[model samples]
Target: MGDFVKEILVKPIQYADEVVKLADGAISFRQDCLEVKTKSEKLVSLLRQAARASGDLYERPTRRIIDDTEQVLDKALTLVLKCRANGIARIFTIIPAGAFRKITQQLENSIGDVSWLLRVSTPADDRDDEYLGLPPIAANEPILCLIWEQIAILCSGTIEDRTDAAASLVSLARDNDRYGKLIIEEGGVGPLLRLAKEGRMEGQESAARAIGLLGRDPDSVEQIVNAGVCQVFAKILKEGHMKVQVVVAWAVSELAAHHRKCQDHFAQSNVIQLLVSHLAFETIQEHSKYAIPTKHAMSIHSVVMANNQKNDMDVTDANYRNNEQDDECKSKIQRPRGCQRIVKCTIW
Candidate 1:
């Protein structure tokens, strides 16, 4: 069967499909290829070879490589997982940090969307466009779609929409409980840190979110901190957009959740101020509800760390308690609540 596949099925794709017999033969070969055992060394070699071959056709039929890549990835991922079924997780334990770093560089270069790129990396950093090529203006949606497709292969068929793949990676980073088993402690961190520094606000936000997730794992957190992810997040907190602000705030909170020292670092970086300011102006219900208060808590934590300033900052006040009550009343009355509590009534 392997010989039949190599001879009758695989060999014919190389020739012109002018005759009806050739097209039929190619179809039969594709079917045979699909039926090949996931553990077959031949299939693995074929996939790797096909990927390399796609490179030679780089200038022409770039789309063919893209299409073939999709097929190859789909098949290879199944094989890789099957190979890992037994103590495969142990393989990553021996894999060096530098090895994961190299793979991550190649992965980022192959991505096709800049906005999607930003979500996956740092918003302020420049991308390696020379390797990825200028993002096709007409291909934004399609590239984003393909990026998600690749991510889905990594995720266990749980992700259907590609848009969620980047977010899923971020989520993986934040809560090692979800994907820490499949992904190495260092597997997702390097690309995330690099993204945390480059591209656009959306990309950086995504990377920051992942960094935050990665920090939840004890092993991952130490490496990310050692790699200076916190410093990058602090920079974004000061200069990024609302979405970027929210993710960075969450990432910092996750880092602080694991280590008290992170609070002190954030304080020294003046990130506490930015978090406070963002909480002050945030209006989106989700942002105001989760992010703003969480950031405020982190800020107050920073204050505590900086001065032992156990100033009894009311948790309710920190929760935007006054504004929320007013909103609740206004919604019930169907009218804007006017200024009603301006009298000087000190809580003495």
Candidate 2:
């Protein structure tokens, strides 16, 4: 591979032409470019070689190639981005994630600024479960953060800074939107709930709806309820948009089943009726089965205890107790005279 890269690097113009031709498709393009068919196979091999090589010999040449846009290397960086954007997937098992981030940072700098580079780093929503199994950085923080920050910049930033501070203001949450520790602490649920309450119609609507989903987590609701958020959600339900209404109703149902105080308050506010009405249309009988064990267990215990009291059967009577056994057996066979009236009242 090093020999191949050396061969290509010697004639950089030819390498550059192939790289650009491969990446020149339209932005909305969805086709896969085969590495074996194009220079990607060779280029990926070269990247690995450059990574493995030590000292200034590798750095100087790699920097020169990355820095010069007039030749093949510049086009090669663009090609990597295009290949990634078109959904050419790979396992990072052979290559470390940090190496990928570093290489990608160089490519990001080389591309100047593109609106859709934002979308490239944003992992597919359906891919979240797969991502969560990855190491911490790849799963939790910078991947989504990079996407958010990039889109924020591309959508609203000036030429100098290139970020939408307003979008981050209204929508962003810290730490990959985990909302666990944050929602449990003081002031955790406030920002999202406030966004729903006070942000612009679109921002507020989305924020409010998100708050409703966040409410499903028990710790989050306990903190939000303790902070007096239910009333605010109730008001939002009365006047929020259709999406907000749907989310708020779902949120209310979640709150209702978990916190009795919240359920009572929601009932008094009349939101429970609305949530119940919605549930009637969407409910599955299996959904109610989750809570059945606790109810069934309580009912069985109550019936057993009540029947035992009404039976008047001695746990150890003359039929079971032996007089010759000991004083312990005699004591066990008799109830104390002081308890006679109580036993008669309960058992007879």
Q: What is the per-residue lDDT of model 2 for residues 1-348, given as tens digits with 9 covering 90 to 100?
A: 334434434443444445546554423221323331244434444443443432212222233343342343554444444454534343322333344344444333323211122222233342332322222222345444343333333333333222132234324433334533433332335545555565555555444444544554566667767666667666765676655565555555555555545666666766655545444433432243233233444675445544444432353454356555455544643212322232222122
Report lDDT (Cα) of residue 125, candidate 2.
Answer: 40
What tens-digit string does per-residue lDDT give for candidate 1 at 225-334?
A: 77777577767766766567666766777766777566666677777666665544433322323332334446653444333222223433544756656554435321
Cα miss at 116, model 2 (Å)?
Answer: 28
Work out candidate 1's RMSD over C-alphas: 19.1
User: Clashes in model 2: which pairs?
Assistant: 16-72, 152-164, 153-162, 153-163, 157-163
Number of colliding residue pairs in each model: 16, 5
- Cα deviation at 214, candidate 2, in Å, is 2.9
lDDT (Cα, 0-100) at 339 in candidate 2: 22
Find the candidate with the highest lDDT and give its number: 1
| C-alpha positional error of residue 212 in candidate 1 after TM-score superposition, expressed in Å | 2.2
List residue ranges in candidate 1 displaced over 4 A. Answer: 1-163, 170-178, 181-186, 199-204, 264-348
